[model samples]
Target chain A: MAELTYIEAINSALREELARDRGVYVIGEDVALGGPFGATKGLAAEFGERRVVNTPISEGAIMGLATGAAAMGLRPVIEVMFVDFITLAMDQLVNHAAKLHYMSGGQLGIPLTVRVQQGAAGNGGAQHSQSLEAWFIHVPGLKVVMPSNPADAKGLLTAAIRDDSPVICIEHRALYWTRGEVPDGEHTIPIGRAALRRPGKDVTLVATSRMVEVALEVAGTLANEGIEVEVIDPRSLLPLDLDTITASLRKTGRLVIAHEAVEGAGFGAELLAQVQEAAFDYLDAPIARVGAPFAPVPASPVLEQAFVPGAERLAGAVRKVVLGA
Target chain B: MTSELNQQEAMELLRTMLLIRRFEEGLIQTQKSGISIGHFHVYIGQECTGAAAIALLEPQDKIATTHRNHGHLLARGADPRRLYAEILGKAAGYNKGKGGTLHATVAGLGFLSTSALVGGAVPLAVGAGFAAKQLGERCVSVGFFGDGVLEEGVFFESLNMASLWKLPVVFMCENNSAGALGQSAGEYPGSTIATKQLIDVVAPFGVPASAVDGGDPRAVRDVTQQALARARNGGGPTFIEARTVRWPGSRPLWPELSTGETDVAFAWEPDRIPMAHRDWFANDGLIRYVRQLFDAKLANTKEILALDATVRADLAKAMRFAIEAPYPDPASALDDVFA
Candidate 1:
């Protein structure tokens, strides 16, 4: 195993994909110039200009071109820089890439991966801080993945590169510096599965992205308070691991959904519906969700802290579900 | 230079044009009778243009078109019955009843699927052309669009990229003079001049371009032939502007809801120019040659109509099969969401 940061793991995954598949290529606005966040540093020099291409400031053209290239048997790992910029290419993603397979009656496959930084990190407020995973997860034909740690970030992205469908892989800018133990060689994490971070019996906590790490922390603190918490990290939001959640709900009988996105209309609503429908009878109490408030992420640090959900909010939700607080 | 096509080849072109005209006329009638449903855009006046452009292409060459695409599809040799059934929303349709008139596709037939969104298919052709060049297939990718799509920035970007890459793509602008009632070429003089100057601007980028009379199918065909030959020889992309007149709903079979009171009077007028052109040919005792050509075209179209009927019937059966095919299990809805 090698100690690597999230950004390093991503760079490593890109290198491996490029070396392994001749069809793979990368393109973005500043990708060749070491990327906007230096995630692709030295890639252009190592792989040459053709494989690591620098494109004009046309997100729509970049994505449309990538979709067309992927359909023509090229594995394009497109970096849109920020998830917010993905709005510019929504038509191509929504109309063409996502619907091509089902609309074409299975004649085409879009094996393209769009890499973007998602969720709030540091003081990048409002425009840059929003997490839009729920929007993509709503689309049917796309695979939405939000990796919380370095290991799964590399493994899941590699698998996404090789998959026969379009994958929207979101990484948080905050997690890029966080370190983890990733395998030395090639590895892959299946897209639809969830990972159990902390096993407990009192209450089940489901989280994604950076929220997964916070939920694990809260579970540890909750254990000392005589209340055990089970934490489940859904690596992929689109292909949700309902089997894992359903099994955990059967044991705990209490659930708490958490994410960095605002509380209302977030992925929390979808998870609540799924768990309530499948494991409704096993519930000892109604499920609770801890998330950002239903408002834009504020610019001030104090307001930003109040806006995002953290371990304190999650632990409070677990206490409510478990101790009837 | 113009004598490459013999009389036989010329006649074949006319026959294809007639086939599209008659098929569209029939569809207009059927659609009005409630036999076919949903949005149906006919390319009546644009027949000659499509026939001519497609005639230049070999069966292996690929083409992409916009939503107003029946003529283009028929010109590219799509089976009329499957297209008709598709318009009728039958399971045996091109997209198995899912994609209607706007989204009909037959990929294996070298008609790479069309995008209903304007200018969407143009960039796709660039990628296809790039792939064809990489594979050394000696094939050219053609993109067909109306005047409305020029307003999109991607159109220029596509031209620039395709030219820079020296990809074999034919970007044909069927400037039909109208983008749904607003005069197209007149509204945007600045862009029009730019578009008019595309051939010169693109030449230096390694891609050559030209414009033609879109109303004249013969002219379109000739231009396409040149473009394809240039492309196959690795001469890069070309942009052609086919300046054609839009015959506003010439097929009186499908009348607008606003034309309800005067529908019968409208039907009495002959919207097809060929029928009128035939009489003009006859008054000078040149009727013999015209009659012989018209008779052969009618015969060929009748044969295609017979096949169209069989395909429609087969598609009806397929529709029944799909409708009764059972809705997917609700539980399965939760599946395939992630991976």
Candidate 2:
């Protein structure tokens, strides 16, 4: 095993999948030219232009191409430059790819993977900064994945490439440089299984994306105050591991969900609802949620910080829900 | 090359056009009966467009279309019953009742898929064409849309990309004079960029194009056959504009549609439909002589409807299954989202 950054792990997994399957290929704007984030650097040099295609600046065309290719028995890994721009291709993702198999009486299989970078980190601002995973999670027949760590990112992405459906794997711009030990050789992670990073009995803290880091930080701080909080990173939001979350809630009788998206209808709220519906009898307090306010993520660093949930706000929510203060 | 299609083939083509026309009329009546609910745009006068286009396609070729899709869906061999069930919102419908009237899909028949959004299906068809090219398959992806959708940027971008890559696709524009609310006058800058201008726009892209009379199946078939044969033989994309008129009042119009007082023959009504629609429907001198054509088409349609009954019953069974089917275990609502 070697320590790799989230971006490196994702690129490595993409490379491995491409090498492993002849049917697999990558397409997007600047994907052949090393991409906007350079995640696809040196890929075009190795795979040639046909495999690592550089397309015109048309998001809809790229996604629609991926869907059509998937329908035609090709495994296409499409990279949307920024998650914000994915809105422009929403028709392809929602109307075509996601609904193809179900609509085609199971005669068609859409083995397509869409990689997108989302969320606020370096003031990419209102347009560039968005956690639109919740939007895809709302649709049926789509797999919505956002990994909080390098290994999970690589593993989940590899799994997404092989899955026989449309999978949206979101990479955070903030998590790209964060390093972890990803399996050196070929590895695949099962989607829908939430990882229990730190187990405890006092309260269950569920988080996703960059917010998972905040929950882990808050777990440590709360531990010093004699509060044992379990931090659960829901690697995939759509096909969520409800059984594990419900079990955690059953053990702790308390739940605090967090994410970088707005509180109104973020994945956190969806997680909370699942736990509440399944383990409502075990609840000792109202579920606490830490999320950004419902507004366009601001451009200013300070305002962006205030707009999204951080370790401080997350810790406070845990304290309030756990210590009853 | 004219010998490629025999007398039987020609009759089959005419029969298919009649089926599409009758099926569309059925959908309109189904909508009228309140069984199907939604804003439906039926191709009442454009049956030849679908018949002729599909006649040019092979089994491996794929197709995509816009919201006004009942005719194309049926023309591509989709069962009228499951399609009817799809419109009925029954569980056993084509898309398991998920995609209603606007979004119908049949992968087995090579229809690939359809979408409700304008200009939505164009890029997908381009992508399918790209896939066909990549696989070294002798196939073409055909996309059908109205003149109103031509204004969309995705359509232009698709045209540019397909040519840039030399992908095999036929961009069939059914310029039926009027779109849902906009008239051809309001939709276009002027007749300067008429169907011929559309062909000219794609000429420089190295993609050969032409505009044909959409109401006449022979014209549509002749133009599409030349285009599809060229595409399969590795010639790049081709854009064909089928210049047809949607029977007036078939769809609601905006900025006020011309009243029927001046042109009663051009008006669309329930009883004054189908067989008599050509001469009686239009201001033509061949009104008395059209009886033979109408009688022949009527006999063929009656036979086709009889064959359609079994499929309709099967679809009805599927509909019963969907309606009586148990709802998702409220908990399973979140089941498929992640996995």
Candidate 3:
């Protein structure tokens, strides 16, 4: 095992997948130049331009090309510069890529992986910083994944490239610089499974993507106060590992769900509804949710800082759920 | 210039156009008789464009088409029985009744896929060419769309990328001067274009463009051959705009009235339709091609009648097979939704 940042781990995964399968290739805007965030740095030099392709600034055409290439026996890993731009390609992704295999009556398979970077950072403003994982989670025939750490980023991406269906991997901009220990080679994490970050008996804190780190920090602070908090990171959102969350909830009756997206119509609402349905009788208190207010991400530093939920907000919610305030 | 055709080639072209014309007529007759249901776009006047363009492509070459795709699929050699069954939503259809008339796709016959959305198949053909080039395959891919597709941004993007990458693809635009609602697309309220010639739109991308008479099968076949040859020789993508007209009977058939707004006077007598609108019938591409065949003496009156009889008998058998085919089991609806 070696310590690597989230972006480095992602690059490692791409290199390994390109070397392992000749049918695998990368295509997107500026992907050959390592993209805007440097996640794909030096890939073109290693794999050559044929494998690591650069495309024009056309999201619809990029998605269409990837879907067609995937249907014609190539495994393509396409990247949209930002998650917000996915709206431009929604028709191709939702209509063509998601429905082709089923519409063709089992005659075609779209083994394409679309990577999108979300969450607010660097004061990138409203158009560039919105978290749109909820849109993909509601779509059937699509696997939605959000990796919380460097290890999960590498392993989940490798698994997505190998799967025989369409998958969307949402990577947070804030998590790119975060470092963690990742396996040396050939590491793949199974989709639809949640990872337990911490164990506690007082309450369960369910987090996703960058929120996992905040939840862990809250757990550390609560540990000094003799209040235990268990953190569960749901790696895959669509085929959610609800059993793991329910098991943790069984141990700790109180629950607090945290995410970076808006509180209205966010993925947190779905988790809250499902948790209540599964473990209604076991809950000692009503579930709590921590998310951004119903507003677009701001451009100013102060406004952006206030807009994002942090460890302090999560800790406050955890205390309220535990103390019945 | 139109390509020169020998006797055998001229006969085959006429035969292909006749097959498409008769097949669409059979569909209208069956629908009027209450044997089939669901809406479909008929390629009545535009049959020559697809028949001749697809004739230039090999069986292994791929082509993606729009909603008006029955003619293109038939021209690419799809089985008549399976295609008819597909329109009937039968278990024996090309997509096993899962995809109806709008989304029929048979990969074995070189049909990559069909989209109900206008201009949706343009980039898909470019992608097929990109894949073939990466895999070192010697086949070219083609896309068939209408004049309305020119306004879509994806079409322009596809042309630019195909030219930049030097991918072998042919963009065939069938300009029938009408949109889906039977209105002149050029005169539509929101339609605005700077160039009167469709070929000029792609000239800025450095791709060779041409226009031919879509009413003549020989003209379409010759132009498509030159485009395909250029693609095969590593000369990159080419754009061809075929100017044609939609027949008056191309709309949905209504047999209740003898002479209504959407009704044809001689529904059964496709051969005797007048050659001009002044004679109460529009000039059709299939009729023009058939006349050329007779004038050239490539097919005598006896041979033309014999071919028509064979096509009618084959279509009758296909309609019977479709009527008898079983419906898909309801429990299997959830199947094939994923790989």
User: Which numbered prediction scores highest in DockQ against the true structure?
Assistant: 3
Q: What TM-score is obtained by chain A of candidate 3?
A: 0.98
Q: In model 3, which runs have C-alpha deviations exceeding 4 angstroms?
A: A276-284, B1-8, B184-192, B251-271, B274-282
TM-scores of chain B alone in all candidate structures, in the order given? 0.72, 0.75, 0.89
Query: Tens-digit lDDT track for model 1 on A10-82?
Result: 9999999988987888878889887977888889999987788787777877777777777677888999988
* lDDT per residue as tens, model 3, B16-99: 777787777888778888876587877767888998888888866888887789899888888889988888988889888887
TM-scores for every predicted model: 0.85, 0.86, 0.93
Give per-residue CA lDDT, model 2, range A109-130, as digits (tens). 8899999999898888899998
Give the alpha carbon lDDT tens digit for every residue of B243-319 in model 1.
65545453223433221211111212335324534332222111222233344453243443453455445545544
Of 1 and 3, the candidate ahead on lDDT is: 3
For model 3, the docking class works out as: medium
- The C-alpha lDDT values of all candidates are 0.75, 0.76, 0.85
True contacts kept of each: 0.27, 0.51, 0.58
Q: Interface root-mean-square deviation for each candidate?
A: 2.9, 2.8, 1.1
What is the fnat of candidate 2? 0.51
- Write down the C-alpha DockQ for each prediction: 0.33, 0.37, 0.68
* Maximum-lDDT candidate: 3
